[model samples]
Target: MANPADGTVCNGKLHNHQKQSNGSQSGNHKRNGIIRETQQNGKPYFYNKPFVESFEKVPMYLAIFTNLSYGIGTLFGYLRDFLRKHGIEKCNMAVERKEQNDFVPLYQDFENFYTRNIYMRIRDSWNRPICSVPGPTFDVMERVSDDYNWTFKFTGRIIQDVINVGSYNYLGFAEKSDESLTTVRNVLMKYGAGVCSSRQEMGHIDKHEELENLVAQFLGVEAAMVFGMGFATNSMNIPALVGKGCLILSDELNHASIVLGARLSKATIRTFKHNNMKNLEKLLREAVIYGQPRSRRAWKKILILVEGIFSMEGSIVRLPEIIALKKKYKAYLYMDEAHSIGSLGPRGQGVVDYFGLDPCDVDVLMGTFTKSFGAAGGYIAGRKDLVDYLRVHSYGAVYATSMSAPIAEQIIRSMKCLMGLDGTTNGMQRVRQLAQNTRYFRSRLNEMGFIIYGNQDSPVVPLLLCLPSKVAAFARILLKRKIGVVVVGFPATPLVAARARFCMSSSHTREMLDTVLKEVDEIGNNLSVKYSRHKKSACPELLDETSFELED
Candidate 1:
């Protein structure tokens, strides 16, 4: 046996012989031997024949390779962690898989949620645009407050002034009326400003009862009930009056509060086209079919709801047509005179008075005192029995705190003023002045090429802008010129019908109107707005129009 210099053994039988490098020596090394061989390159190399054959069985080499693999994997994992910490590795494959698994049912849930949100979609679908004017908050405030000669102050420069048509004091009763101020003072002194409890509890005050009576008397109804607020009154009263198993035939353009109230009632609700008597009649007929009389007890009552005046387009509801439909369908009529009372009719008694329709013809008459009375509260007047029923049963009136004593007193005072002994004095004078102002403003805006909507007699003069961006711009420019007007869009009105709603107040002077008109014309010209006259005819010739004919 020949041994290598490293002293390794060789297997002769399984090995093959190889030549040595010592000067042509005829020596043979075993094939499976550990030997040193000199190659042609003059390098001596060592090879282990048996060991190479069994390399897979070597534990030491396997361990070394396993360690190297693990080290590389650990380094990669650290790098991944670093990237994740810095938000560089955005997509988490594992998380994505988990999310997909979780989202399948969630997606279905979302679909169901959207289906249930139909009313929300309907309410929001009418969002429209205005103008594209822009400016800083401070700049807008300075312009509007100064131009309108209004005394305005912000609690801090950081807060912006709340600008909306609803925010303006329409009758000048908010800040200008001494009587109103005194009433509030007396109420605060006596009742401490707030009721501090719901009406059913300790909030029912004598002032509330008095105001309810006054409202009922004004509307020529037997009795009335008051609520905490206008919206609450609508939302709570409508549903409380007619809930489950009842049907509600509502105008398409009715206020959101009415819609919400009907929905909350869980009643079958059918919406007719805006002021379309035919559609209302069709719906009423269909309701009869759905609620056919299996028995006398099985038949359900129907309620037809309409606004006295549509707020968005400033259109007055055709009360006569609606009343006729109600009579035909044998349905109860509920009129929300929120925007009409104190702004329409002979003594501002609203739609019924405007049409000279008997109060008995209508089932329920609801109104708010925020606008003309310069106070905050709402009431529903109707048959004494119905009013009493609502007072005891309507959740809005029963649970909510009654109207403040001061507000009630103020409203009563205002109502008394409106119904002066001479009929053409006091609040009547204010009404006339306001109506004349509205007419003058509408005519001037029409002459200057603005598309004005609503009845000429309406206090609400909406200048159509057609785009939300344009409406915003018109508002910004007006504010820049010191005019505090409202730009209404989206959800309030359809997106395609966005407008700059100018609510003319009795407090606004002729000089103020002229200045506003001139500024509006200048702005319209600069913006290339095509000013056009409103093509709609005024109300049909009633006895009231005889004044103009007689003068002619």
Candidate 2:
């Protein structure tokens, strides 16, 4: 791996990347990266496309036939629906067989154990890929009740419509048919589909420039750089910013992408309790005193990583105190605003705006448009020098395709609407309605004896269903009642903290909220998951998980 901060690969090669002085940043720079290129061709590959490279040798006609056959097989996938609605499908978990005597029986038979005990019971509900647009309401293949089991019963249906509290489409923009989406349509006519190449490879478009400007303006930053995918925006950019000599102090509950990015950067990483300022301050003090973990040498840089809004917990970042600590400890702040941008704050700029904090207070500001903007990408906005540096050195910029022209337009138009600059208050209205919706939902759930996690203002409201089996039961029962709820157990969250999270939308009506609350209350009561006066847990769920969190 290369140390990007100093512009040199492991072999002492002088890469094209060069650092620019803040006062003299008009300089241009070139970016370069390499990937394992030659792809093995099977039947020369089942599909011989002009774009993808294959390494296997086979005739063209055979490849074409293979492609057609694969399509045919995929076309008949609906046939599986015929049998699955009746009997339980055996799961194919990733684990080795217990063939050899020396092979660890537990490890080798893990797949079989999971399939029999866990997956076979809940696999049907876990990964139900949707065919229709996701929104406040969407269509899903409804399972038919064929027989009764210990946990639940199978139904007599194949598909049905359900209310969606599962998606992150906070403003309903993805499913909107409003005048704002018309801007996306107009741009599509002019720009075709994709930009066809990475922005570094000459695919940068004018709309990309406008989108960056709007984002910078919205977030009160000096400049902004956009990328094609939201997840990669953080995963790739972190490596470009920090390297081995640096230290990263991360939130214990930060996103998986941030975790992967820190590991890739090879930085000495220390974790703080989630949103716990005291724990963070403690870690920061240690980093400043002892420096790198094993080396015990002076640190080159220290970056504090956190999310604007934690997705699973639905909690807001303590920005004010965190900002104070960052300055006190002389650490750079990296805030991933994926959940907060276009969702929180009166103006919808994100957590910084929500807290009325200075954008310059944080070092590297990150966010995604896929949430409230109803678009497809993310951006890193900060000082002009930081933006410029990332443009030439970030791996995503070096290899990933530029964000689509029309999708950029969608973001631009959405930002303009939020700012009330497009001759409409629709943007502000969406922001206001979402705020109202999230509050109302939380209050109702609280009133109904439900144990919910997250701050009062967050659109992501999670109901703590303590038992893993209750996660499956909550989701299964809710879906049968024509409500779509998102649930996650064990690996995603701690085993005891499994939850069914409800994501509120600006598009949800008062009636929709009422319907969800009523149904949720009844189901929670029936399942004995409700927290009544006589039935409170010995270990209260109100005890913030941060208190007992094990730092990494």
Candidate 3:
């Protein structure tokens, strides 16, 4: 995928993004020296080991490696170049100053500093919004019209469509359509588009209630409440549900919204290692025993928040294990299904259905409609009472604009189609095919000597490219080759593991994927980003590359 519409912007959003030692105060053994080599699971992972790791106080680690074949002076030069290039050192300096309150004087010429030394010298590679719709293949603009100009790059031509390996249109329902499109149209005819009021006031429509019912039914929940924006559905709702006396057990890789929501709740937030259930259990046990530091009393409530799928890592949640832990701890579970709903399981009811787990085992089930539903907004599904409480208490209901009736209708119709009430198995078939696409693409990519991430069931697949330049080069090369893929680096993922993320869709044909795979294989070798560092894997032998589908 070239771009993710629902890109979570969550590489350790509220939590610290750096990878630190598991414990505190290991002590500064050395500084301004050659970085000690690092190993992952006993083998060297070829990552940029830190030149100097700040020990004891600040807990900072700077990994700047440039050609170990060269000397220490070469290392320093690369460090300086990197600092200036990413504005990372500048950011750290600002933070250090901010900690001292009046340390940053009013006389600081911020604009002048950025223009003269920072912004002007930096690359303008990010935040380039596409004017065209993000579809399976869509037109991308080249420049602002001066007589007449619209250029699309790919296939060595101008103003032509490019095959998208970007965009999180998981089920290929992003475009405006037959039944779902008609539903939206009919809704527009009746509601005349925008409601133009808060959901608390006159904005609430019959379709809103109807849509909520469909979502609840689809996910096998008692009830569901929806908000106009997907991000707010969790961020705004978390505060209302969990408060100061509560504790939030969050996954380290949770989305920015989850992090923000935890902050808003004013709860004591403790993060567990991503998908590490043992670490989660340890944290829960500790929190349960110790409670808040000052009070030494038990927490008023405890909320275990996790995502159904980790977007950046391209990994699915260990829902069954997490559920067991939550039950043992007697804590409420909040599952953010933003990337998983309508893209998992036999019937696409999400992780719960995929694992055949009890739906009610989860206290709060959250998801965004943007990915799989091909609609806007988000839903929080749980018990009827929790939803009823949120209607009056949730700030989103009182302040935010209601989701347009048309949007709600579209979601309703889409859900009906998925549930097979639309007199067709089109949606179900799409789900199965999308899974096949994911397994086939991942299996083939892995076989081609590209180290891939995420569970086999997920559509989000990321290929690791160690350096930032390689990440940029990969996006550029793939675009020139007529395939679009989303590149993630530095703050979005960890500093080292920069990768190109390819999101699979049911609309992506076997031929299209084969073309993409071939182009990517060529580019990976040309850019020298393929599995040079990959240790011998026992898994690659398991993948059958002759066919496009995984063995049963």
TM-score top scorer: 3
Q: RMSD to native for every prediction?
A: 38.8, 18.2, 13.7
Q: Per-residue lDDT tens digits of candidate 2, residues 1-552?
A: 323322111222211111122322223222111111111222111111111110112234533554564355335433433344344543233434447556655544423443434545565554565556787787775443232221334344445457888889897777756564787888899999989999888898899888888787777767899999999998999999999899999999999999999989998898998777789999889888998768899789999999998999888887767887887788899999999998876567687656544577789999998888888899999999999999899999989999999889988887888877899878878887787787667766766666666666678887867555566788888887878888876567764566788999988888988898888989988887764332322223323433222111
The TM-scores, one per candidate, come to 0.68, 0.75, 0.77
Candidate 2 lDDT for residue 16: 16
At residue 142, candidate 2 shows an lDDT of 42
Please provide the root mean square deviation of candidate 1 (C-alpha atoms, Å): 38.8
List model 3 lDDT by residue over 1-552, tens digit each: 111321112221111111123322122211122122222333222211111110011011212431221235346545755785577654322223445656755544434342233222222222234555577776654433221112222333343467887889888877754645886887889998899998889999999989887887777768899899999998999999999889999999999999999999999899998887789999999989999889899999989999987888888787767877787889999999999998876677787666545577789999999888888999999899999999999988989999998888878877888888899988888887887788788777766767677766678988877555566677767766767778876556665566788999988988989999999989988986665233332234325544333222
**Global lDDT of model 1:** 0.61
Which is the leading candidate under lDDT? 2
Query: What is the TM-score ranking, best to worst?
Result: 3, 2, 1
Candidate 1: stretches off by over 4 Å: 1-168, 177-180, 289-299, 421-424, 531-552
lDDT per residue (tens digit) for residues 1-552 in model 1: 213321212232211112242333233222112121222222112111121000011133433544454456447656755675477975232223345774544334323322222222222221222221111111222211321221233333321332323232445454544544675677778877677787778888787777776777677667788776899888998877887778888888898889999999888788888766678888887776657434433336899989987777677776666777777778899999888888776566787655445566789888888877777878888888998788678888667777767777778777877767324466766666666666677667666666666655667777766543356567666655555566665446654455677776666667777777888889888864533432222222211433212100
Give residue 249's lDDT in candidate 3 (0 to 100).
Answer: 92
Question: lDDT of all predictions, in order shown?
Answer: 0.61, 0.71, 0.71
* TM-score-best of 1 and 2: 2
In candidate 3 the C-alpha lDDT for residue 128 amounts to: 36
Scanning candidate 1 in windows of ten residues, the lowest lDDT window is 47-56
